[model samples]
Target chain A: MHIVICIKQVPDSAQIRVHPVTNTIMRQGVPTIINPYDLFALEEALRLRDAYGGEVTVLTMGPPMAEDALRKALGYGADRAVLLTDRYFAGSDTLATSFALSQAIAKVGETYGAPDIVFAGKQTIDGDTAQVGPGIAKRLDLLQLTYVAKIASIDLAAREIKVERRSEGGTQMLKSRLPCLITMLEGTNEIRRGSIEDALGAARSGVLKWSAADAGIEDLTRCGLRGSPTVVKRVFAPAARAEKAVQIDTAEKTLRDTADELMAAIFTRQPALEHELAFNSGA
Target chain B: MSTVNRETPRPAAGRAGIKKELPDHFKDYRHVWVFIELERGHVHSVSFELLGEGRKLADKLEVQLAGVVLGPPGEAIGNAIAEAFAYGADIVYIVEAPLLADYRNEPYTKAMTDLVATHKPEILLLGATTLGRDLAGSVATTLQTGLTADCTELDVDTDGSLAATRPTFGGSLLCTIYTLNYRPQMATVRPRVMPMPQRADKPVGRVIQHKLSITEDEIVTKVLGFLPDSQSATANLAYADVVVAGGLGLGAAENLQLVKNLARAIGAEYGCSRPLVQKGWVSADRQIGQTGKTIRPKLYIAAGISGAIQHRVGVEGADLIVAINADPNAPIFDFAHLGIVTDAIRFLPALTEAFTRRLSPHNRDKLAS
Candidate 1:
């Protein structure tokens, strides 16, 4: 089995902030991390490779700096990494992104082997669109499954796989054919720490770099801002509330006394809540 | 696949092109359409919520608002259409087929995409549920149009373009997107983000029936079974009156017990911030944030939550929000109605005990008398 996983490099959301005056993102000092959600997909791909005796290749599309994210995925036990970077790829929305990635995955198939499964994070923190995986699946004509909680089983001979797909309030047991695309849900598995040997091998392994032409993208108009239909008109910070939170002074009161006072304050503001709670509690 | 039109000239020189003209092929697109999502013989509330929003946009554009209903050939489809009329649809499009009985990507995508091609709509809205997201993504790709997911606000701008506002950059800022050059501007809004509209006693409006041309053998994927969550395990966070959530501020996973204790005592739903879900302390279903569930409880008690922008947007709709955290400088304090700077590990227990004692039968009976 050959498994391909798509990962992205995104700014650490914890340190991201919006400028109060200009309403623009403050990206000056923010460190980039392998979109935390992608780690789950990477870990799941590695686990499948370990169990099935195959190789896992990680893929990403970004600037030259994104090679760092690919190397990090290699350190987590991937066999190879491929980076698709080009000036024409800038400003590509989710639609253009899926086009570039599907083309690159085809290129990977020619050089290495055909991938049985294509994996990606459910969504990206920066884009938060969750549209690219499905777009890629549609372009590739693969069976697409998003929000997969668990892989129940895979029968390579029959070319079938079963998974528990997470839904609104329950799960759906779905069966599909191989060469499918999956967007793994977060927290499904913990990413393993690289061993000393693994880290040393990852440091020496070079990532295969590809440009738009190298990846078999013939249409320049379809690779960048020209291909993106959705345009961001304006970005701004949400208006601040005129009133700040009313602080409850815990300086001079015991914990018990503060709890009592807090309850009093709540009931004073919303009198209907007391009766509603009483009704629900059967008090 | 080239979108460049040789016949139509580009906008005149020098000025920035913020409002691009609609392409000639897409010029006739009119009405606002909402896909009414029905699964397991029941219509999801998010569909009605989108209709409510769709009504406002339709009125703004002075166009007809329609609900697109696709389901098995049965009374469930009829019932869903009737409910769509009650929720404020000027028209309802029905596509009945056994293939669409359960949502497989193949048939439903074909039905909706074909419907859009036949009768062009300027805007298409869908619920951000599992089925809706699955179907919307495929349909948008098939139509080669732009789609925005989990939008918080939707409106028609002065140029008559759909302005879809959603949080971006991990919810730190809000951006409004426009599909100016595409037909049928599409978007998905999650449950509880919009208020459920009041149902009026209105008859079903004009019905337009479409055909589904796919068969079972054509679909590559099949639904093997359905596993419904146990009644005890399901948390109704979206519609709960009161919610109690924990965050990473809780030192360890075991500390989540404090949050559950308070929730049980107050008859509230329990949840956690996004990081708690990522840390494996709680399931993804119980996560409250941009990527998880957006809740609008009447009262929200946030313990040990630092209230990042992602988590804040999810619970900000609550009427009364009280935040308890050890750090006084936590961002949660900025929007919470009541802020208490203290250790949640110690304060949660005290709050639970106080609510228990105050709401006991003995105290209620005495106060009533």
Candidate 2:
């Protein structure tokens, strides 16, 4: 079996902050990490490879610096890494992204091997759109299973795979044919640290690089901004409220006293809450 | 007015510019359509919320608002149509077949795309739930149109384009996206992000039924079974009247008990910020943020949460917000109605004791006074 996992390098969103005056994201000095969600997908792919005796290839589309993300996946026991980078791919939205990726995935099949399963994170934190995985599945004609909490079973001979998918109010046990795209949900499993041997092997292995042309993207317009149907008209910070939080004085007061004072302030601002809480608690 | 940031690269000028006029074929695309998500014989509340929002856009554009329902042929479909009209839909478009009973991407995508082809809609809205996201992505890709996901705001621009506003760059910034030339502009809003519209007793109007072209034998993916989450395990945080949530500042996994204790003391639902879910200290369902549940409780008590924009957007709709954090400059204080600077690990227990004493049956009468 051959499994391909898509990964992305994203800025650590937790560390991202907006400029107080400029009201713009301060991208400078912010560190980039492998998208936290993708790690779950990568780990799941590795586990599948280990169980089914297959090769796992990690793929990413980004700037040259994204090679680091591919290498990191390599260290995590993926057999090969592919980087699809091109100048034309900049400013691409989710639709254009899936187009480029689906084309690249087809090329990967020709060069590496036909993959039985493709893995991706449920969504990237930076975008949080959760569209590209389904988009790729639709473009490639692959069965898409998203928010997969667990792979219940996979029958390699029958090309059947069953997964526990997270839905709105319940878990759907879905069984689909192989050659499917699976987007793993976060917190399903913890990512394992790379062994020293694995790290050394990853550091030594050369990453395979492919441009849009090399990836067999026949339509140049569809690869980037030109093909992107959605245009971002403006980006701005959320407006701040007129009044800042009223500070409840805690200095020189006992913890209980401070708590009482805070509760009093809350009740004063929203008297209905106190009554409601009293009713609920008495019940 | 805000200046456009350099990091947000605009579409290039000239041939690829967004200023290009809508193609003549798409000029006839008229009404606004909201995909009424029906599963297991019930309509998700988010569908009604989208209708409420779509009604606004439709009113602005002076066009009709239609509800699109694709489900099994049964009384559920009839009930959904009636509810759609009550929730402000002027027209109802439905495709009923056993193939669409359970959401299989192939059949639903085919039905939705076929409907769009037959009756063009300029703007399409859907709830950003799991089912909606799965269907919207495939439908949009198949149609070769634009789709924005998890939009916090939906409006019609001056030029009649759908301006879908959503958090980008991990909720650090908000970007307004427009599908300039796409015939059926698509977007999905998360549940509880938009206010639910008032439902009135209105007779169903102009029902248009479409045929599902696919059969069960043609569908590859099969739903073997479904396991509903136990009532106790599910967090009803979105509709809770009072919510208490913790953050990374709780320090240890065991520290979460303090948060729950306080919530219990006040008979409130408990949750945590995204970091707690990421760290596996809490389940994803209990996460309160843009990427998680967008809650609109009456009273929200955030303990030790720094109130990142992601978390802020989720709870900002609360009637009153009270933030407790050790850092004096925490962003939660900016919007929290009341702020208390102290260690959450220590403060949480004290607050719980205070509430427990105040709300105990004997003291309840005194509190009521």
> What TM-score against the true fold does each predicted structure earn?
0.94, 0.96
Worst 10 residues of 1 chain B by lDDT: B1-10
The all-Cα superposition gives candidate 1 an RMSD in Å to the true structure of 4.1
Q: Which stretches of candidate 1 lie over 4 Å from their true place?
A: A20-22, B1-18, B326-329, B367-369
Best by lDDT: 2
Q: How many backbone clashes does candidate 2 have?
A: 0
User: What digit string (tens of lDDT, one per residue) describes model 2 on residues A25-62?
Assistant: 78889898998999999999989988999799898988
Q: Rate the local accuracy (lDDT) of all candidates.
A: 0.86, 0.89
lDDT score at residue B325, model 1, on the 0-100 scale: 89
Candidate 2, superposed: residue stretches over 4 Å from native: B1-17, B366-369
> Model 1: number of clashes?
0
Indicate the residue-level lDDT of B285 in model 2.
Answer: 86
How good is the docking of model 1, as DockQ? 0.49
